[model samples]
Target: MSTDSPTDGAGAAASVQRLFRNTVVAVSGALSRRDGRVSLSVSGLAYFLLYLAGLRHLGFGPSGYEVSVVSNPLVRAFRQVGPFQWEPIALVVVGPVELLVAPLNMLLGAVLAALVGLNLAVSIVAWRGPSACRLGPGAGAMSGLPGLLSGFACCGPTILLVVGIQASAGLLSLFQWLLPLTVVALLGTLLWVGSRVETAQQVA
Candidate 1:
């Protein structure tokens, strides 16, 4: 058994509370302006579409309109075939585009997209604001890394075709963690950016 005491637990809880409060402050502050709102909407939508494209759920095909749903979609939606990936239970085709409707995957992608958007918006707003609040290019890079890494993960074996790299067990194993790592990085960077924003507010 672990030896952590009540005081340690309380301290950790307080720390988490502070972090969340600061993050909320940062987010609310960013979204209060037109630029931040635009950033969130555009970036979020773009990232979500890119994420679906990475999953190969949205793509071009013969021109037609059709919607197909699998039997027992509710049950199938929970089925997992890869790390952070779920089975698609429907097919939607309209014109030259097609989409595999996977409820779980869509949910996950939405979450990742939202995080990426918020990260970019907060970082961009902070960087463009007063001198004390400038977060710089590092924030942009951090915000982008998750989308790229997770996109590669979503591509699965197909990514090898794009990168021209031979597949191996080691490489495949690494892919399993990419989405999770991306999530962690997104959250961590969000908190870090918020902390900077909070500090800047304090300084000013």
Candidate 2:
């Protein structure tokens, strides 16, 4: 009976130690996640608000008058840039309510939200076990890509707003509208890809 008593006491002590260790780990993880969640929300909301404001200023129309094929002989010479030649193509002036910018803006917003969520996850894992996060500098950079992508999405509309407003005054007549078109196209493509990443996460 004496020996059995010692064995039972030792087992209870071991179990208590394990329970304490687990409790500490869980609390640490939760705190880290909470910190990351706040960061993500601040950054994401800033981008969403900025984009909405910029879109409001980019009143509808081809931005500047659409360049026609006849008006832009350079397009024929530059076949690759032909799609950008706004002139001659039938124009559809969109109303404020008909703005098509929402799709891409919302897409980027979604990616930003995911980025915040992933950051929180990583933080929690790191808190639970430092080795579990396994993210080096490269991984950190990769993780930040979604936020950068969101920046680009917002910048696209900003560029349009600037060029469209500038050209309206004939100040940038010499500067081709191709600049805005190409920038918009590139950023739009990136936002689309980022949206796909965000969508996949929802499915998972």
Candidate 3:
């Protein structure tokens, strides 16, 4: 009574494997597209360079000279936040630039953390459906914009304060909150986009 060919089962398995492979390729290709990759790389590299500069300024690099507390607007803002603990690690005079290593490190860390969140969001969206795979990279990049804006604004306020402009404590607090909000927004955007794409695919 049962006359199903063995090859039928093997063929079905092979077909599924092909589909999975193709989906992976499509998602990776979309993320690695020229524009998307450039945007991500530029942001990542900029953050890394800034972090390196901060390290150098703190006398922890090849061009380092001394350990001194560099007072700046950003440093003041960080002090208000109380998230970073700044301490004098002995002095060995080298230059005359005000460099707040703790705050700079925090800024770089936020960028890296944001980037990781965005990547996860993209991966989720890309794996959801074919349409989502097409939309994931661009949407992920757009979502990351808020984080970048927050990072820039964090430093911007301090710069203005350094220039003798009155920067409000409330404004600095708002920037501090923006980083977490950006991560939440990115996750939401990816979920929403993925749902819409899945729905559209179903309807089609």
Candidate 4:
């Protein structure tokens, strides 16, 4: 048996460096080198985190559910805008435009408006590194945690079953509503899977 040479260790080190460099370049394109990756990765992460955080502003949450059947704010807004007025100006051009969208529009304006507002709010706020860097990233990560668990095999139908049970009761506790919510999550998963399958088939 022969002992390893110093040249062999040097070659190994160089190979690792090259591999790391290539990986960074692939995710981040030309900008992945040095400090650029830090900035881009942080910002992208912030944007995604904020987007999920904004969903909290929706009427539903862990504490209690809003029992009202009224349209969500965004849906109301969309109705006011109408098909003809869907241009860029609708976001902040006029406050009174919301009034028009609320009652007159045929579609779900309030729900649409609320979603847009939530996403925009999250994007703007999360970009500032909101609070200290540590806290901000932590918060963002927590907000996104639900999306990760969604991949569990039982998560989909489990939710649907829970939701059905809650609906049967005619009144639901906070945790009880989770079933229906789970079902909705499952439906979203199915849709995503369907899309992927369709795309794959098309490619084939």
Candidate 5:
């Protein structure tokens, strides 16, 4: 017959408790590392709100436009396909350059939001430590600069519009595409960073 020692049982219980405590600490630390990303995203959102408010206060709003869809012979011939009705495409009527201000501002705001989301995701991976994933320190923070610059595009154009300066069609087109490009770039950066982290984690 065998009897368990009281001291051995107590030591086993203490070991389990210690392991639980360490796990909790590690989880909390990992979560806390995301604080910076959260703060930046909130700040970016606030800036968007302020910008929209300013635009409304300054008498800027959506311009009137109409779009129609019709089957075109040229399009059909180019595709070597039978007559087909094209999809309804809404085209903003090109009016006074100032009229483009509101749309441009909206685009920039969207870009900023996208950037913030990507930055937060990247930051989380980065904070997980090199063992979890390998992103150089601060990579997530630096990724936000393009989004910030895109936001500035809206401010600068709005200022020019308010000052009665007209922007050329070419310039307006550039602004039109800038937001989408910025969003894509931010997404690409996020993917790149995430892949690096994933790869490192796998290797480790």
Candidate 6:
């Protein structure tokens, strides 16, 4: 048996810590620039709005101005209606705009949006900066595609599967895993993008 198991484990822990630290540093540095901030804000906002629109929470409807809350807003907010979905506890309408206020969903959307925004921010900054290593902004930009796709996957699982192909238990289970998979994808891509960016000390 290898007597260096403790050393190996310690090394693994240190590696993970270094990876996270580097990722954070890269993201922070990227977001510090004006162009990076603009990219982050625009991409994040667009994603969040599309996310809500996909969920039928935000759209154009009858013209009106009103705000209504469910009887138990707090309790209703956390009530799950589907895989990783919570019930909306309020409705807001302003002229032609309508919105369903679901706290949990909004929170998730924010997180996903931020991840995507950070990915783009870092990628953009890296591409514009002079780096010692070869960098392709496309790689980092495309990484967020899965997260975007998965967000739409949560809108509604395809009910019609090639007319006759039935969804198996395994396939059905996969639908439920989409959101979690997206989160993992987003974080993984963020780390990947961050790893390629300028380090904290080299940041300008």
Note each model's CA RMSD in angstroms: 4.7, 18.0, 11.8, 19.8, 16.0, 5.4
lDDT of 1 at 102: 92
> Candidate 5 — worst ten consecutive residues by lDDT sum?
80-89
Measured against the true structure, the TM-scores of the candidates, in listed sequence, are: 0.75, 0.30, 0.41, 0.21, 0.39, 0.76
lDDT of each: 0.70, 0.41, 0.46, 0.32, 0.45, 0.69
Clashing pairs in 2: 66-86, 66-87, 67-86, 67-87, 68-87, 68-88
lDDT of 4 by residue, 71-182 (tens): 4555544442222222121221122221111222212223322322222222222233322111223333342233234423223322344334334333323333453454
> Which residue pairs of candidate 3 clash?
none
Q: What's the lDDT of the predicted structure labeled candidate 3?
A: 0.46
> Of the pair 4 and 6, which is ahead by TM-score?
6
> What digit string (tens of lDDT, one per residue) describes model 6 on residues 40-104?
89977877887777566788999999999999899889999877778999999999999999999
Q: lDDT of model 6 at residue 200?
A: 49
Residue 157 C-alpha lDDT in model 1:
45
Highest TM-score against the true fold, candidate: 6
Q: Rank the candidates by lDDT, best first.
A: 1, 6, 3, 5, 2, 4
**What ordering of candidates by TM-score runs from best to worst?**
6, 1, 3, 5, 2, 4
Error of 3 at 177 (Å): 3.2
The digit string of per-residue lDDT tens for model 1 on 1-204 reads 879999999999998887777677777877876778898888778778777776678788999999999999999999998777899999999999999999888998899778877777776666566222343434544534543444334444434534457678676667656777777877887677655443445556
Candidate 1 lDDT at 133 equals 34
Query: Cα RMSD for candidate 6?
Result: 5.4
**Candidate 1 Cα outliers beyond 4 Å, as residue runs:** 1-12, 130-173, 199-204
Predict model 6's lDDT versus the native.
0.69
Query: Model 5 — TM-score against the truth?
Result: 0.39
Best by lDDT: 1
Runs in model 3 lying further than 4 Å from the true structure? 1-29, 47-100, 103-108, 111-113, 116-132, 136-165, 196-204
